[model samples]
Target chain A: MSEHILETQNLTKEFKGFVAVSNVNLSVKTGHIHALIGPNGAGKSTVFNLVTRFLTATTGKILFEGRDITTTKPADIARLGMVRSFQISAVFPHMSVRENVRVALQRATGSAYHFWKSATSLNELNARADDLLEQVGLLSHADALTVELPYGRKRALELATTLALDPRLMLLDEPTQGMGHEDVGRITDLIRKVSANRTILMVEHNLSVVSRLCDRITVLQRGAVLTEGNYEQVSADPQVRAAYLGGSHAA
Target chain B: MTKIQARNRLYLLLVAIVIGLLAPLVVYPVFLMKILCFALFACAFNLLLGFTGLLSFGHAAFFGGAAYVTGHALSVWGLPFELGILAGTLAATVMGAIVGKLAIRRQGIYFAMVTLALAQLIYFLCLQAPFTGGENGQQGIPRGFALGILDLSNNTTLYYVVLVIFSLGFGLVYRVINSPFGQVLKAVRENEPRAISLGYDTDRVKLTAFIVSSALAGLAGATKAVVFQLASLTDVHWHMSGEVVLMTLLGGVGTLIGPVVGAGVVVTLQNTLSSGPLNAYVPVVLGGIFVVCVLAFRRGIVGEIKALIKQSF
Candidate 1:
């Protein structure tokens, strides 16, 4: 078995009287694309939140790189080379695409507190940001303010920013939540290209995208894991079909 | 060098500084000092409000608290003017750390309220503190020369001193906002969750901005105490806090030159109004300006100008 980059054993989350995510086990191997697919309110995002330390798990162990990081702070978790993109676009609207990428690069490289040095003077940092922007296909729009970009481009910028962190694991919460068909296709391709190096655990609602991109699939329903396998095996499972696929097993 | 933008901001700043230095020769030295002092104060407040997006309502605590400390040191202990100001600034920095730690726990309006309430508590403390001299305040503070070489009793020397300090404070504020740390603060302001996910501890960033802002406000207040040769209850009052906010807002909350312009307008208005028969209505006029600015001109003067320039471009 390949070494798991992230593992959660008996992970659970409770909100007031209700359990949002219950007694779930998740294992994401290194350098593979794992997709968490679920219906609305199925706690897929909550699992992402728990792993990223945005929301604490009520009970469980989260092992990152073979050590327990269950109660680590979000920033610390990010610093340890795990970063997440938001469900909605979270680019700095007033800043240019280049500026947004530069900020991320500065933060990741531990130079965010370089008071005497001007941001523009950091030649290497600027170059890195430029390269990432090019990779995300935002080179032409680098000078444009983020708010001026279309929805798909903003999502691409978010990916570029996440890439700046040099993330060992990338947690994407609906990377293509609001994209049209062409945009979705572009992002799906981008994700595949990105997953060539880093481990990607994404929460995807689009079944076709999930089946297309995910190397392994985890189906979640009512805050619990329904089933888990490769796309073919999980889609063929009768319980998964009844509860999640709605009696469809075309795959 | 991008042709130095032809505007040559550095040249502009030098010209402005030269104009400021020559002001006392053409106008009243006292009035010039007041403008310079308040300009520094506004710049300090702008560091937090504009750059960090953390609006502090207890800035008067630093401004007035430093005044009280500097005044006491000058009058009672007979400390040198520079030493007294240093002591005052140190006091404010300490107060700022305490208040910043508490206020940064809550964001937006809650942070504002917590700072205001904490400042009010400091005001009460000053009112009861023996050295503060109560409502009478500490008066007749000595404005000694620089290292006992320059005579602050001379108006020109004093004006030049104030001018240099104001320029330094203004330059510091400008430098901070343009730095990488400042970019991070902007990132935090624009999208905090994104900042956090990028490995930034935003609470720490906010706290650092708050402390730096408070310390600078204290520095301005200490300078003002020496300029006026007195520290009064007016420095610590909540009204003073409101005035700083008005200055920053009227100038342009996030723009570099906005607070300075705002300070000039407010100080000039107050100076003019004080000599006129409408002196008592100054507060009403200030209140009106605030309301009008918030409603009709949300961008303020500098912001409006920048927008126009960008549109023309």
Candidate 2:
């Protein structure tokens, strides 16, 4: 309804006396692939956590689709259509790959609260679950135990499960972190493919992936925004260059 | 479940049924009923530990608490056995709701601590309560007629009754773990934060599981009261709580049938070693087996055997 899908106004979070995310205002436009880029300890994940209500903001207002959700419970916020992924692959490791996706789709079947009903009642979710898996190239591994999947494949499976939610806004924290080069590229491409129709806000370390996939970038330094622009504009900014060099040195 | 998996489970259940029918013939009926009662207790405990990932150390409160309630209802009020057990189950359910509400506010060791502390309180209450008969226990509890006709006085008749109750509890657990709700519980166990981000109300899920486990445990205890015609402080003791944990862990915490096997082994070992030259070493043998289970057979006997089979194929 608003120009921005998600807007955080003067958000700030502090632990004890230390500030993790300083006063920050971020607006993610609808249907845009927005990237929050920062070095380690720049509070990127903290922002994601705060936005998802995993952590309470010391001071701020978060608006999702123009609705004030700064005080909403985390689970309620998620059900309100804003879902997040963890820095690590979020999954049910003991279940099969398809079953992992089915967890998200199971809510649609209205039997998530029915313990007496057989799990086979979820058969209706299978076609969609497999379709999501195929989208992430995990269809062949549908029957494999989630824990047994290779690391890269596990990340792919995370994407499939997230997609199963069909969320209005997807907050992915470091979707390609701890991956090999091929995996990073494939994940970057997968993100691009899935970015249609929905809005996305991601925290990524790889600048090339950011440049290739993200429509807009917000560079953060010391828990504050350093600069914001399109890739070329950000790449040409001198302060952005110094921050990257400083960030790398700090890393 | 897949077709092959369902068939395998069916075969397993059939085998259990066959064993239940024949074990009383080869073994003492009273001893076999004891095994069945404990097996149901262990399985009910497993629903929380293995499936839901909640380790409730105060389960003795539910198991023993129901025994006292059933004992009072039957001996003092002359209620039917079915209603007496039902009353006991309802009491446990109410206790579970209250305990679960408070305990789920914490997690892991803290959760276990809350349950343990509460169960210990229940033990003291049982010790001091006049109606419970204190140290003497509620002895001479009449084994009344079942469903108004079948005489439960016969050991063989009672064995079948006990078997039926165990089957009902086991079947309910199996059905629950394979249901959609069970999937959420496992997801909570596997990754609680992720489940939250996925919009599942984990607290409610956990509370429901706690209540179910408690009610089934109470059912087992009420039946035990009828079998032994006694309810004692021992049922609510911290030792009883610890015993169920040992059974669950030894049988394999997460495996459905593992707890039953674990309960059988422990009950049989205690029975066999109670009177012989090894009478003084019952605790030693049980502790030794528990250590071995934690060390090499970490999945418990059934879990390890199942894993071995899976790996072989």
Candidate 3:
């Protein structure tokens, strides 16, 4: 837990001759907020997909917690204590907020297959589920259907569900995408609060949030790491500025 | 489930039980029994399509496969009623596991196609198999006694037995849909990727549900064979599969009681109409009703009613 929680060695992915993520080496240390930042089409999502096994790597290896997971299934990767949250705040929309958390908690009760027992039996986990909801400041909306929740609230519920898994490492894909300034500030604080005793690897576009939250930052350009350092060093890197400015109209 | 929702379902069940117990005095027990069998069939199908969002087009394989097994068990093996139904259910469970394993690998319409194709293979096997009696089907399956005690030869007695089986099957469906397992099933239905990311082996979850639903469907089929003492090609036919889907949709797809209500209406119409002057137009009429139901309210009868009740509150 004190060393690297996730390591990818010369990882590469290609779609029929077009390289999407290429020869990238990434090592995320434990108990820290590690940010993967690049401009659009920088293969951030591709590397995530490769490590999570959503797509097979063209070449190279991935190791999580000292075990090779290059060929593992996505669910197995998660089961191995590397849970991922989607960019869009993936959740069971029709279920209540509490129910969403409970779904993740069901596996831990060791009775996820008990179809004969009443669901009320799962009420034992209600307190724990509520605590998760409370941790994310969503206790008041526990009974509300997830689809009925406002956009920001849905993101919080997603975090609660992710926390319910309590993985050793959490992969968040754009956890604060498409949010207002106030919502982003609130979520940044929430993520910081939840990062204790666990590793968080995030692919984020918002640099201010990254500099504010991440302990270490990896900058990618064209599917390969351009620089890896603290926020100040990465921000001061001339290549990082050129990649960002030339790649976008922001300048 | 919430206390209020559970109580509401309990009340609804009570009402249905009263009707089931007393209706035989006025209605022909055989007709009522047919309705019960199809109702159970529809309910089993709903567990997959309604609850789990899997649309299977080959359910008749399970239904009719169990019927043939039950028929053989009672007639050839001379087993008791309970054992015969259990044999049939076991056969369907095996079938479900195999079919689910293969079919669930594909998704959506491909899943439907896989089941349909596999069912057709089973249908052909039934037609060619020596024990199945080919076109004649397995016939004269004795109702036999329940545990060698009560006489199943009596229509009323058999009707009550069928009622018990239906109740058990329905209750099992209810418990499963409200169980911890059911939550994961719904989660998979709602968002499969999210479920997968949560460390759920979704294929396994889906397969388990398929087996349960198939076993229940087989139970209905076996019971029907016992009640009528016959298992025919019609039982395994694609039309039978289509008919169950119609029943589920006409009533309500996802609602617990929707399939039952749908089966009752469909069976009643098929009975009263096909046996009367409107027999030739029975299919047309049923088709028309299905069209109207889809167009006017795609949620079906029970779903629409539930929506209205929710709206009022």
Best by DockQ: 3
Clashing pairs in 1: none
lDDT of 1 by residue, B1-313 (tens): 2457536877877798688867787999988889888888999999898888889999999999999999988888889878999999999999999999999989899999999999999999999999999999888888987788999998789989888888888877877787888889899999988999999999898888888899899999999999998898899999999999999999999998899899999999999998999899999999999999999889888888888987997
Which candidate comes out best when scored by lDDT? 3
lDDT of each: 0.90, 0.91, 0.92
lDDT tens digits, residue span A1-251, model 3? 43999999999998988888889999999898999999899999998888999889999999998899989988888888999988887989999999999999987777778999988898999999999999999999999999999898899999999999999899999989999888899999999999998999999999889989999999998888999999999888888888875634542
> For every model in order, what is the number of clashing pairs?
0, 0, 0
DockQ agreement of candidate 2 with the native complex: 0.81
Q: Give the per-residue lDDT digits (tens) of candidate 3, residues B152-188.
A: 8889988898899999999999999999999999999
Cα lDDT tens digits for candidate 2, A1-251: 67899999999999998999998899999999999997788889999999999999999899999999999998888788898999989989999999899998886666776989988888788999999999999999999999999888999998888888899899999999999999998999999999999999999988888889889999888889988999998877788777775634422
DockQ-derived CAPRI band for the predicted complex in model 1: medium
Q: Can you list each candidate's DockQ?
A: 0.79, 0.81, 0.83
Q: How many backbone collisions does model 3 have?
A: 0
* Residues forming the 10-long window of minimal summed lDDT in candidate 2 chain A: A242-251
Model 1 misplaced regions, further than 4 Å: A245-251, B1-6
Task: Name the docking class for model 3.
Answer: high
Q: TM for chain B in all models?
A: 0.97, 0.98, 0.98
Model 1, TM vs. native: 0.96
